[model samples]
Target: MAQSHRFWNWIARRYARMPIRDQASYREKLDRTQAVLQSDWDVLEFGCGTGTTALEHAPHVAEIRGIDSAPKMIEICRERAAAAGCANASFDLAAIDRLDQPDSSLDAVLGMSILHLVDDRDAVIANVFRMLRPGGAFISSTICLEGQARLFRQVILPIGNFLGVLPRIHAFSRTNLIAAFEAAGYEIEENWQPDEDPMKAVFVIARKPA
Candidate 1:
């Protein structure tokens, strides 16, 4: 947890100066995300760093809540929400295991660059399933860790980041992930590559069956 805290502190700093590509990607993703929204949906965004996508999507919906494990990241999200005048959006700092929301409270849940950060992916999915109302969905974009990103995160990049370790978050194939989500009670709706190599993050939308 200490490592993650320090690691995300650096990430928050880096996000403060995101490149044009990063900013553009988030903007485009928000459009794609909004296209799938149900009118008046209650949305929950996981791993919402600095509320980038949360604030972007909040105005397009009735209610949005963003969660992150990093305290500083959630603080940045709060600050951004205030700056954007997004009263419908809120930010919380909580581990996946400690999420305190009521059962079946949300209409949909989103995980962007966030699932791989979890140590137990299936358990996280199960927790998400428990939080969503019937027929709700979980949208995610993930690092497969089978591609160049693995080499960079495991070998080339510093040894400090385990979020990319092959046997854990990055270990499963896309098929395996689908199966895992299914096991956790979601039916896969959409899955596709949205970027280039090493970082060819794939997006998925999985819904809880009614």
Candidate 2:
């Protein structure tokens, strides 16, 4: 785990230093997700690192809570939110498996690049299902693991695995992802692969039946 932490520290620093082109990709995804939000909604953003997107959409929502498991990430996110004057958004250091909110209280749950890192993705999905009110939507994007082997797995991730790296858990097939969502009690609303991004990620929107 120690080596994993170091490896991730480097990854985080690298992400923090991403060029404008890379940052644009993040912006496009955030914008696409935000465009679907309703005006009177209370949102919960899972795995909200640094609270950047939460801050970006705070002005349009009734309330937004940014949740992350990493203390350092939460701290940075809180600082970023305050700096951005995002009065409607707050950051909490909490894991998705152990959500602090009441069941059926949230209107929407947004998770960007999160489930792939979790060992118990199904549990997280189930918990999110309980938290979102009936008729609520869960918006997310996940990497399509089948295609990643060519670019990231074989070409790159092998180096990390050699260093006794942490297990980078990922299982993203269109069928598998939709099945997981259905298993968690959501009905699929929108599912597609946008060509603007190169990460092989697929955008998905699902709703809890009323």
Candidate 3:
């Protein structure tokens, strides 16, 4: 995790400056996520790179807290929030697995493009489940490394990680991802893949039983 933190920190500036890969797809995700958010809800977005999505959702929720392991990422998030005047949004330098929130304390948790990056995704899912109130949602966008992208995870990424040139990436199929959420007791509310290509990220909205 520490090594991943360093890698992210090193790329934080470039990452913040980069534009969203797919604007239309990103908007669709934001719309779907907003539909699940209540005006008075409290949200937490883990691995919130530069806090773009968190800030976008801030106006719809009472407050949204963004957390990331990289200090530079968190710093950039704070700066973006301040510049945008998004008072309802805040950021912290922390990892989701290490976050100590009281059980059933939050209204929703967002894990956009983050689950596969973690060391123990199941544990993180379990922790998110425990943090949300009954009927709360866990929204996430993850790249499931299967089909065409399988080689990148199985071969290229391994060599890059070994050479200290790339961060670690976990490879799992889309079926495996859905099963993990269901296994953690979350009911699937939405499962979407914007592109037919296996390289596209899968967006999911899961709810805890009320």
Candidate 4:
């Protein structure tokens, strides 16, 4: 975890400057998430690098807390939140597994491009589930690396992470991901893949039973 933090902190500047790889898809996600969000909702967005998504959703919700393990990432998030005058948004240097949000408290929790990088995705998912209120949403956009590039997941990614070129990645199928969510007692409200490619990000909005 320390190594991952250092790697991200080292690259924080370049990461902040980099443009979104899929602007259209990003917009669509924002729109979809906004559709389900109420004005009085309290939300959490873990792995919120630079606070873009949380800040974007701030105007729609009462409060949005963004957390990341990297100190530099949280610093950038604070700067961006301040520049945007987002009083309802907050940023913190924390990981989802270590977060102690009261059970059934948050209205929504967002995990964008993050679950795959975690050391224990199921535990994180369970923690997120515990934090949300009944009928609350757990929205995520994850890169399922199980398909298309089998060799990349089995070989290249592990080698890259060992060589300090990539962050820790867990390769699993979309089926496996959905199964985990269902096992955690979430009701799948939305499951979408932007394209036919299996390697593309899968957007999900899983709701806790009300």
Residue-by-residue lDDT tens digits, candidate 1, 88-113: 99999877667888999988888887
Q: State, as a TM-score between 0 and 1, how close model 2 is to the true structure.
A: 0.83
lDDT of 3 by residue, 96-136 (tens): 88888999999999999988889999999999999999999
Q: Distance from true position, residue 177, model 1, in Å?
A: 1.6
TM-scores for the candidates: 0.86, 0.83, 0.97, 0.96
Candidate 2, pairs of clashing residues: none
Off by over 4 Å in 1: 20-28, 147-150, 162-169, 195-198
The candidate that wins on lDDT is 3
Worst 10 residues of 4 by lDDT: 1-10
Off by over 4 Å in 3: none
Native-structure RMSD, model 4:
1.1
lDDT of 4 at 74: 95
Candidate 4 per-residue lDDT, tens place, 27-132, comes to 9999999999999999999999888899899999999999999999999999998898889999988888888789999999999999998988999899999999
Candidate 4 segments exceeding 4 Å error: 1-3
Instruction: Estimate every model's Cα lDDT from 0 to 1.
Output: 0.76, 0.74, 0.92, 0.91
Task: Give me the candidate number with maximum TM-score.
Answer: 3
Residue 133 displacement in candidate 2 (angstroms): 0.5
